[model samples]
Target: MTGFPGVRPRRLRALPALRDMVAETSVEARRLILPVFVGEGFTEPRPIASMPGVVQHTLDSLKRTAAEAAGAGLAGVMVFGLPETKDATGSQALAEDGVLTTALREVRAEVGDDCLVMSDVCLDEFTDHGHCGVLTESGVVDNDATLELYGEMAVLHAEAGAHVVGPSGMMDGQVGVIRSALDRAGHHDTVILAYAAKYASAFYGPFREAVNSSLQGDRRTYQQDNRNLRDALREIRLDVEEGADIIMVKPALAYLDVIAAARAICDVPIAAYNISGEYAMVEAAAANGWIDRDGAIDETLTSIRRAGADSILTYWALEYARRGATR
Candidate 1:
């Protein structure tokens, strides 16, 4: 046969060592953050049905899990708390003894400085209506009012020893308000991971169940539209100007373009959330014997890294870290 004129691309893939050496993307265990749920009033860890192998943890269980993650060399753990009570104001969100703050303290104490402890600074998990912010008399989300509460929540989380507080509510000027709150409280060292471009995605279904969300309706008014790419960059700019230490793009798989675009313009570290729906889809396919579970996990994570994420928040972080360690 005549030799092809063009250079051969498959030579690099012909050998495993060559492929490894030529790999452009890698997922480091120390840069992966696991999202963990700690529920109030749970005597034992409660399994989330839609998300297999994930559980709503009690304080004791949360400690154990945090310990394991730290031991596995995972960078951090993002905590979402399920409070026992809900009200119009999401009062528990700012309460010193609230589920979230309490869990933050527990996790911080258990892991110490070995791992970064991050808490979700949003009211949705504590509010009766399940909206991210407080509502007005007409049932509309009051953006300004919500900022004040977010500020308060940020201070509380900082006091509780959260090394990083992620404001995931998509509220306007949230990053500035949170930064001010932390600084005023002498927590200037605490980092703010801004959910700079969160989309109102349908992929959040499993998360709602995981946090026992009491959402009455969709959050379209607050979250960014999934169709807008230019706006995502604008959001990143606002967050960066407002002193966000890191900017995040949520629903990582569906928003890889946004992550890549943000990486182009953003100077701060960029994070992408490998959201619940994305995890569930892989789990479901793997359970059905339609996909190689471990391979899919690595590919998806690698794709996110390749798309320009400095760090990834994923449910599979702990599992992948443990497996990666063994290998």
Candidate 2:
């Protein structure tokens, strides 16, 4: 054979320094957001069986962890609360003394602008039925009514010192309602992180346990179908139009294409969740000697960034940050 017609690219990949210099995508600790689950009425951290190395943090543990996150230079920490009591309407969600609201205040105070303090604005963790919103007399989730509660919840989170509020319930017009609520409440600077194309995926199994879910049926009625790309883009566009500061796609690994697609038509920053099941699978495999944990973790995060996610919500954010992301 003879002279090649194209340039040889292996030279660029010949050394780590060469590869780093030419790398098109990089994962940084500052672009990774750690998702934290804070439990009410617990004196000690409880390990989550489904998620290895993750735990339900008590209030004290939660503040310590938030400080750790800030010290690690993480982009932010997202808070999910586990309440001791539940109800049909999830009244605790709006209570000033509620678990989540309290955690938000503590976390924000602990971090103190060092890292963003974000809160999950949904009723699932607080509702008795385990649905994301209140149900009708017929036992179906009321979309319009849910929007009203979401509006209130967003304001509460903002008032509690949340820099960003994520509405993951997938209720129609949720972003708009929450935006209006925040503006009216005089918290106009609070950012709205829309769970724009959150798919109703089975990968959420571990997450259900993490939050002690009381899901009655399923969220397919509200969460987007995994089979439809058009549906994802539609939701993303609508959220952007409705004042979503940043739009997100859930279950990042399986929906990298959707994440890339969302980036294509979006003018705002894009975020993707490296959800629980994805984390568990890798952890399980590593425990069983199936894969290198750090390697898998780095690859998983890098792939999301490569797919155009401006930031990633992940269980491994702190671990990855501590070990140093592949930057």
Give the Cα error of residue 137 in candidate 1, in Å: 0.6
- In order of appearance, the predictions have TM-scores of 0.98, 0.98
Q: Over the stretch 117-198, how does candidate 2's per-residue lDDT look in tens digits? A: 9999999999999999999999989999999999999998998999999999999999999999999999989999999999
Question: Which regions of candidate 2 fall more than 4 Å away from where they truly are?
Answer: 1-6, 325-327
Q: What are the per-residue Cα lDDT tens digits for candidate 1 across 1-327?
A: 467756888989999999989999899999899999998999999999989999999999999999999999999999999999999999999889988899999899999999999999999998999999999999999999999999999999988999999999999999999999899889989999999999999999999999999999899999999999999899999999999999999989999999999999988999999999999999999999999999999999999999999999999999999899786
Model 2 lDDT at residue 282: 96
TM-score of 2: 0.98
